[model samples]
Target: MNTKGHCCPKYVILQAVYFKLRFTLSYRDVEEIMKIRGVIVDHATIQRWVYKFMPFIEAEMKNRKARVGKSWRMDETYIKVKGIWCYLYRAVDKSGNTVDFLLTRKRQRMSAQSFLIKAIINNYRPRVINIDKSGSNTAAIKVYNRRSFSKIKIRVLSHL
Candidate 1:
């Protein structure tokens, strides 16, 4: 294909980058497949494309859908970053796709509420929230539910 007038290399590269993200494929694998199709590209080039186009993709996707849907599930995991404890709360929608995430220093009621509020700001507030029996989660829900705010939140707790 010759682009004598409209090359649109940005569009072409964005398409390739989106393909990589959709499948979560490794860079080397993408490079090899593109090479097999006679498209000369490098894994480094793919990485560059990903870094360059991520903001645009995020903006567009956020514009299209800005809600976590009705049924959302949340879980927390602890990780040590540089020997400092970090708590990560990840929420997923009904279909199992991730909706929101939060990293905090404390695993208290405030942290849980912050994560929930962050998720609500980005996505629509969930009607049903499934969380563990952590006191933080329970407390956050109780506070939000009894609040006089415009959007009172209700959360359902479950554990293993």
Candidate 2:
């Protein structure tokens, strides 16, 4: 982010970096884009800018991420990872934005409880959670509610 001694202005460097990251374009492609924009920046320079600025950009993005809604939909399912099956526990807000996810080797009450705890820690506790009729998930929520004395409503989707 510090552009004190650079020949190009901050905006030009930022544009090149943005193009590279946002479009997943190669360094040479970004250089050509800068050339089309009359910037004349080199591919190597663009690469350097990306290497230097990507971490800062990622940190800033995390800081600017929107807060998830209070209503969440939770689920767990099997997913293949490197040809190995795993349980993917996930939660999303009513707007469909991801609240949190965890992949575990086992599908059990402990795993479900861990995922719920992680989601609550990372985001705010949901007012209500809609979930399929999974016994482990139901038990996990019940335990969490009992321990925390929280009256979080659980709406079981029997049709799922």
Return the top candidate by lDDT: 2
The root-mean-square deviation over C-alpha atoms between each candidate and the true structure, in angstroms, is: 5.8, 4.4
User: How high a TM-score does candidate 1 get?
Assistant: 0.55
How does model 1 fare in lDDT?
Answer: 0.75
Return the clash pairs for model 2, or none: none
Q: Identify the runs in model 2 with alpha carbons over 4 angstroms from their true place.
A: 1-61
> What would the per-residue lDDT of candidate 2 be over residues 105-131, giving only the tens digit for each residue?
999999999999999987778999999
Q: Relative to the true structure, how large is the alpha-carbon lDDT of every model?
A: 0.75, 0.91
Q: List the residue pairs that clash in candidate 1.
A: 67-124
